[model samples]
Target: MTSQASLSVTAETQENTLTEVFSLQKSAFQITPYPSLTERKHTLQLLHRLLVNHQQNIIDAINNDFGLRSSDESRIAEIIPSLQAIHYTLKRLPRWMKPKRRHVSWQLQPASCKILYQPLGVAGIMVPWNYPLFLAVSPLVAALSAGNRAMVKMSEYTPHTAELFKQLITDNFPEDLISVITGNADIAIQFSQLPFDHLLFTGSTQTGKKVMQAAANNLTPVTLELGGKSPTIIAPDYPINEAAKRICFGKSLNAGQTCVAPDYILLPENQLNLFIDAFTAHFQQMYPDFAHNSSYSHIINDRQFQRLQQGLVDAQQKGAKIINVSDFAPDATTRRFPIHLVTHTNESMLICQEEIFGPILPLITYSTIEQAISFVNQQPRPLALYLFSHEQDLHDKVLVNTHSGGVCLNETLLHVAVDDLPFGGVGPSGMGHYHGQEGFQTFSQAKSILKKGRINSTQFIYPPYKNKAINWLYKLLLR
Candidate 1:
């Protein structure tokens, strides 16, 4: 067979496999549409044990994919969070599964209303390359906790991690219960076209739009966790050293590849030099020699590295001054790009226009607080917004004036770790939420049900409305 014919046959086989697995999951869900609370807890426990048993393997697989993913970073960001989510869900699963009593209106006095959190049958999760394990496991926790079967699509960029994860899941869980799909973009497109009861995707805004369009054909509801230029504002009253330390930690973690990492900073123009010095000092303290530092993570792959390099080149050509606080030279072979603080940037520059998912932070100075707020408001809504301020009024002002998926006051990125908080995006950043209680709801349907006992108060107006009693009832209801 020719090369093209061989490739076509392989694609056809993969598509058939996806369809078969989806059909199996759908049929399995039909058999046990509502899994018992004990069953759900057992599922979560199995997942927790899987992560615990293969902690080292997970770390090594991610490192192999990234060329130099930090072991500690993987443990801290991926394994720990996955375990915490499971534990949290296990503790609250019983309550979430119980029927919730709802108040009935006066007109419906004979009826009792309640909401049943029913499983969505099957959930489709699309994991991004940046945080492959965490992104995949987090949504899977929600799906299982809500008593739904799930199929996760892992990114091709992290092939090693994806394959390892798929192998691990296959060994521990039944294929029809929880399956992981691995392939390139073509496979991802096919996966998105599946008629899942609910779909949750985490990636870029452009890709999210396409996923949503594909899901629309099946009329599937989606919860998109897309990324945007999340901004940080440092108030004059806040301590510059404290603000710098927190922001640096957030940006340096995962080498600033986080969806909620502070993309840019807004500070008083006069304090720019002071803030820069403090930020530099703190960053150096975090990663003393970044090029050889094992704690510092490299960009995921060549494509991401090249994209970030091009953004830097475009910024410099457009009159932006790029300052490397650590002064570490980037090694393309290793793909270890240092944190760059960009200044004198304009809207035309790619650094200002795009989501800087790497370790590059742009400093946009403003004379007044209003100017800082206005600048953030003018841009597309972000996934996360950070404000460094001690004043209550200032915090309230920014919180009320701005729009984002989540807000961090006097800190950054830690909000996502809170097990009870919902994490997601808004506007161009993305849509819907999935974490803690909100996550359970997103994956389950809040089915409303009204019950009527032998006593039926609604009978008074059930027949033809020609009598005085019916007229009296209508007047009472309208009143």
Candidate 2:
């Protein structure tokens, strides 16, 4: 057989397998749709143990996928957060499982209204290549906590991590309970087309649209955790040195391959040069000799590395000054693209036009705070917005006027670490939230139910609307 035909046959076989697994999970969910709180907690415990036991393996897999993924970064950004999420969910699962008592109107006396959080059968999670483990496990934690079976689709770009994760899951869990899917883009398309009860996807906005479209055919509700040009603003009052240090840490972590990483900076015009100098010093201190530093991370692959390099070139050709903060050259073999600050960027530049998912930060200066806010408003809503300021009025103004998935005042990227705060985006950035309680609720269906005794008070108005008692009651109620 020809190579193309063989590949086609393989995809067809995988699709058939996926369909069989989906049916098995669906049938299993029907048998035990709502798992008890203890059962859910036990499942979470198993996941927690798996992550803790295989920490080194997980880190090594991610490192192999990326040319050089920092071990500490993987633990800090992926393993630690996943473990924390599971821990937090386990502690709160009992309370979240309780049916919420809702208010019943006076006219409906002797009746109780409550919302039951029921599992939504099968949930589909599409994991992104960057931060593969956390993105996959975080949502799975929520899904299992809500008592739902899940089928996760791991990114093909991170083949090593995907294969290891699939193996670990297959060894530990039942196929009908939690199965991991690994394949190329064709498999991803087939995976998304599955008739899931609820689907959650995390990736670029463009790909998010495709996922949503496929889910729509099944009438499936979707929670899209998409990426956009997340912006950071350094206020005039905040210390430039401190702001630079925090921004450096956020952007340099994972080599700026984060969905919530600060994409560009909006600073006061007069402080641009000072901020640039401070950012350079802080970044250098954070990762000295970053090109050869094992502490630093590399781009996930050459495609992403080349895209970032070309973005810098395009910015320079369009009259933007490219400032290499680390003063290190790009290493093609290692795929380590040094951090470059693009100044005097215009709308025509690729750096300004798209989400730079690499170590490329574009700096846009404004004359006043209002101008800064305006500039942000002009762009589509982002997944995250950061402002470094001590002024209460400034914080309130930015919060009131701007729209973003989440905001971190005087900080960057740390908000996601908080277990209580719900994380999601608005408009173009993405839709729906999945974090603490919000996550459980997103995966579960809120079934509204009303309970009453044998007494049928509603019968009074059921028939013969012309009755005097009914008229009086209507008048009284209306008044």
Candidate 3:
């Protein structure tokens, strides 16, 4: 008991240390003057170098945390995309920083209007457990490219991965420029409340609201990447096999822990069994047997595992059908849980109420496209919405009727990979986007600049608003 107490106290002390480091970094940024464009470019280069050097360590750490994530999947999903973001920013930074010209009215004819891109000082990035490295570091890249210093707080759920990321930053860079913070929620709360110029959070919507409230005390700008129950609509016109393959791939990978994963299916009523059979066939082919495959990742932790368990239970209690997809019997060594297919679940059930961050997918049947669109419209916008339809008209219908952060037509959950497209959410799914050029804008502020020759057309309106000449000038220019 005494030893256990000591261990608990030691853990608490370590958590406090992380918060203190973040606070110090914030203060340092506050004291530093605005960073120059050259400096921003240098920071991005350093970040790119770090990612290249520590690729394997990051992959291994993620694997250790989540059991065994696919090596190629982790690299392509986490690092390659980030490196591309860096390269995209590097190639465009000069152009992006150029002052944007604006039309000045003829009344101010001698003046040229421009908008200068400026940094927003220190930025705090709170990363979620899923896709820890990519989500956190990617945002840091944007902040740095925009000439803002960043303090990253990696989720403690993946403690090993979190520590590895912190070490990577500490070994390569000074804490004043960039660093990783690792701790539990209380310490996260302390770090969140610090007066950073801006804060970027990627996590659940419920906690996102709390982070916003904390940052609000200082009126700090925020970018929230919250997850919602993203729905996938399988248009009756498409091939069931192709649609199933993509849908199952997105839903089964990392056991559907991905925020962008299709949360639930909105299928045509008559085609429910056809879609299920195709989906089940794909799921079987992917694993063959989940009882002993080390390639499959387990739940993040027991707490999360229990939550997944409860969601399945809730679906069952609410008269939802369960279609278990695993040959593995329950055991400790292979903590691999099967995916449940719970159809006809009400919105009150856990499967519908919470973001089902697991393999379990709740399939809802709809007779008409309008019904599915209406149901989806009533919910908060999702991170990504998938529509499987070869027909252009149905695709067009889905696009016009429903709202999401982004969309993938005739595909499932891969639109975020396109660096040219802005990746983020709307209403509830997320706020602000960050991937390529959009990311640069997310962290940059445009300061208006007006350059004028020695000609004052508006001088007559300086103090006296009633001057007839000024009124004539105002009318002519405004018109």
lDDT of each: 0.93, 0.93, 0.82
The residue-by-residue lDDT of candidate 3 on 137-163, one tens digit each, is: 778878887877788988988898899
Q: TM-score for every candidate vs. truth? A: 0.99, 0.99, 0.92
How far is each candidate from the true structure, as Cα RMSD in Å? Answer: 1.0, 0.9, 2.7
Model 1 bad stretches (over 4 Å): none
Q: Cα miss at 38, model 3 (Å)?
A: 3.6
Model 3 / residue 443 / CA error / Å: 1.4
lDDT by residue (1-479, candidate 1, tens digit) is 69999999999999999999999999999999999998999999999998999999999999999999989999999999999999999998899999999999877787899999999998999999999999999999999999999999999999999999999999999999999999999999999999999999999999999999999999999999998999999999988888888999999888899999999999989888887899899989988877689999999988889999999999999999988888787778999987889899999999898999999999999999999999999999999999999999999999999999999999999899998999989989899999899999999999999999898787777777787878987787777
Q: Which ten residues in a row have the lowest lDDT in candidate 1?
A: 456-465
Residue ranges of candidate 3 with Cα displaced over 4 Å: 1-34, 329-333, 463-468, 474-479
Model 1 TM-score, all chains together: 0.99
Candidate 2, residues 1-479, lDDT tens digits: the string is 69989988898999999999999999999999889888888889999998999999999999999989999999999999999999999899889999999999978877999999999999999999999999999999989999999999999999999999999999999999999999999999999999999999999999999999999999999999997999999989999889999999999999999999999999988888998999999889888877689878999998998899899889899999989987789889989877888899999998888999889999999989999999999999999999999999999999999999999998889999898999899998899999899999999999999999988888878776889879989789887
Clashing pairs in 1: none
